[model samples]
Target: MAHTIQGKKQLLTRVRRIKGQAEGLERALNAETECLAILQQIAAIRGAVNGLMAEVLEGHIRTHLGAHDISETQRDNDMEAVVAALRSYLK
Candidate 1:
């Protein structure tokens, strides 16, 4: 199913922010930042990415899957895809 353009834009913004965080990390590393500080930054970035994934997954499940016209096969596939994504990220 196609997602709304607005939803796509939101996800894109999140991904861009995560990309910026990664670049910031590279800069931190190059500057020889403190180990603890670097670790904290990494953790923060991970959390942000995880949060974004969760949001997208939630939207997919609640919106696309909830549509009354969706066939059982498509629903199952979408649900499975969400589960797989969640597992990958949680790991």
Candidate 2:
């Protein structure tokens, strides 16, 4: 979470852009925009979200699992936690 705190601003910027994209999609639906353009908007939003997830997941792995200061038990727990989260997210 410390890594996330350090990258808070950058992460928020990405989240804001995703929010904007969602709003744009909503507007397109309300306006009855063409199907292709609406689909493109949805795809952009999905890509942005996936990018955000990947960045945060990488940070978590490096900080929690890769840190040498932590004990083996702690690292195992952290690895399991990461795996569980990935399973949930993928589902």
Q: Supply the TM-score for candidate 1.
A: 0.82
lDDT of 1 by residue, 1-91 (tens): 3554558888888889999999999999999999998999899899988888777767777787888998999999988987787788778
Least well predicted 10-residue stretch by lDDT in candidate 2? 59-68
lDDT of model 1 at position 25:
95
RMSD of each: 1.8, 0.7
User: Model 2 off-target regions past 4 Å?
Assistant: none
Clashes of each: 0, 0
TM-score of structure candidate 2: 0.96
Per-prediction TM-score to the true structure, in the order listed:
0.82, 0.96
